[model samples]
Target: METLHEIPALRARLADWRDNGLRIGLVPTMGNLHDGHLALVEAARARADRVVATVFVNPLQFGPHEDLDSYPRTLNDDARRLSRCGCHLLFAPSEAAMYPHGRDAHTVVEVPGLSAQLCGASRPGHFRGVTTVVAKLFNLVQPDLAVFGQKDYQQLMLIRRMAADLCMDIEILGLPTVREPDGLAMSSRNGYLTPAERARAPALFRTLQELAAWVAAGTPPAQAERDAAQALSVAGFEPDYLSVRRRADLAPAGPQDTALVVLAAAHLGRARLIDNLELDRIVAEAH
Candidate 1:
């Protein structure tokens, strides 16, 4: 696979591929790749003729007190993994190359209501950073399709919405969240978990699952959130938020729809973990 660090070089290679009738697929990541990221590449490869994975630890999305300074950047290992996955191109751009004059009069991309809730509430300008960087990557790569992990469900939804609203001529695909044997969602941030914290992390997923079961059994959404928050507290986590909302519009769950999602985020020591579970409509019937 060819590796290009500069945007122009990467765009030139992508142009050549387009001219040759090769369908381009792009996977944008913040480096520190794991199985979840590779899954995206595999999905991209399946959908298009050429796959390009861009690894830039974007600074725009990170808040002031966030882990941006310590965010893992395993470039060598990431490259090796992408190579094994048969990725055709890898674009790893520097912060300066990406921002040039540093976040100047750039047109910010924000998906109105969606960015103001859930992770949006906690991270402040997180989604703004996400949408802006993703827009930049889309413009730079110009792939026929882009693959994102469903683990960041809100982010994925916003990206899909942004692409559509902005008239981006590319398909946005969100693959399923990859998990560990113990049920913790696989994330690059998982690397920061201390040994003891890592062992306790799966409790987040367990709490989410238990709450989802309650919601499926006709429990009030508020009560379900309360119980999940308690479970997370009992598991030694500092509960950030535990909410049950209609998965379709991300609105609070109501009597009209049987399908719901139980989403939770918490502080397990210094690492902030997030997990969610979807309840199928048939789940209500079974209960």
Candidate 2:
């Protein structure tokens, strides 16, 4: 696979594929790839004739206090993984290429109400940064299909909402969150965990599972959320948020809401991890 840095060079290669009438797929990422990211490439390859994966560490998406500087970058290994996995092209652009006029000067794209809720509420302007850079990627690649992991369920939903509202025709596909032998969600941030913290990481997913059980057993959503947060705290985590919400739009889940997802974000030492469990609507509404 060819790795191109400049936008024009990347566009030129895509044009040749377009000329051949080949369908295109996209998988975007911040470098430091793992098996979970490779799964996204595999998902895209299954749906399209050629896959275009992008590794751009979006400055827009990182809050000032977030780990933008310390975030891992393994471009060489990332390219190797993509090539071995059958990716057609890899676009790894520099910060300047993505934001020639600088991040502060670039136009922002916000998705109104949904952009400021849930995960958005904690990380102020985080989803705004996400939507803007993703909108920019959509404009640049114009791929027929784009694949993302459901691990960041809110992000998957946000990008879908943004594309639909903006009327972009690309298909947004969400694959299941890949996990280790233990239930902890696979993330680049998982690298930050100390040995002891890593051993404790699985508790986050277990807590989310317990929360889902409580809601399924006719418990109030708010009560279950509080119980889950307390459990995480007792397990040695600084809880961020653990709430039940309608998976469709992430509005707080009502008593009888059919489509539901239980999501959690919490701090464990230096690493902040997020994970979720999508509920069976039939089970959640049974009571």
Candidate 3:
């Protein structure tokens, strides 16, 4: 229920909690709260004694042509929703607070290979912004655990890798992707969709599902990716990338790869939606 906007104040509160032996959890987000974001708060509440949810719309993660200025900011409503979801604190900082040195002069964090493909390929310097801001949050909150949604599978993977590579002691947990009844992955950007586009949006998830089925049934990975992209085109989406990659490092999937994920991102009307399914899990359930 308490909201702290400045880093020093938030860090002081977290320090007090740590001194009192309370376990802390962090759920980092850009505002425009929805069920999917609340799900992360709920997961944090279950795992830690106190939860801090951050609501700063990071400018670093957005490209020049992307909706940085128009990205939704519903802070008051987001605060009310997080409090109801049992969040203990909300750290909603201004852009200047996040980048005191200005974005151009700010230190950047890049996961190199991981940041060069899929969504990264399409949105240049996107993950650099993500990794840097997340690193800042991780440093500020210093939580025992942090929760992220699997709806952003690439983001989740890179954060985990960054924390490990940088020797951060915090645990990174990825909760399942929350979805609408029709299977469209719940996203803050979903608000950009018009009513007509919304109706056609579930096809993104359905396309990933079909791709998973194909990979599970022994279809060639490259062929399955091409066919899935084609199917999305027919479903009224301009496909970005529909890929099968090793779930571990997101390297392209080879014939013998068992642990794999089907990931897709595409343009639907004014919104870009992304979704993924783990093929290893699907293949296991076939027996």
Q: Which tens-of-lDDT digit does each residue in 1-287 have in candidate 1?
A: 88899988987898899899999999999889999999999999999999999999888888988988899889999999999999999899988898877765556788899999999999998999999999988998888999998888888889998999999999999888899999999988888889999999999998888888777777877988898898889889999999888888788887667777778889998889988888854433434
* Structural similarity to truth (TM-score) of each candidate: 0.96, 0.97, 0.97
lDDT of each: 0.89, 0.93, 0.93
| Candidate 1: segments with Cα more than 4 A from true spot | 281-287
Off by over 4 Å in 2: 281-287
What C-alpha lDDT, on a 0 to 100 scale, does residue 51 get in candidate 2?
97
TM-score of decoy 2: 0.97
Q: lDDT per residue, candidate 2, 156-215, as tens digits?
A: 999999999999999999999999999999999999999999999999999999999888
Q: List the residue pairs that clash in candidate 3.
A: none
- How far off is residue 226 in model 3, in Å? 1.1
TM-score-based ranking: 2, 3, 1
Per residue, candidate 3 scores C-alpha lDDT tens digits across 134-217 of 999999989899999998999999999999999999999999999999998999999999999999999999889999998889
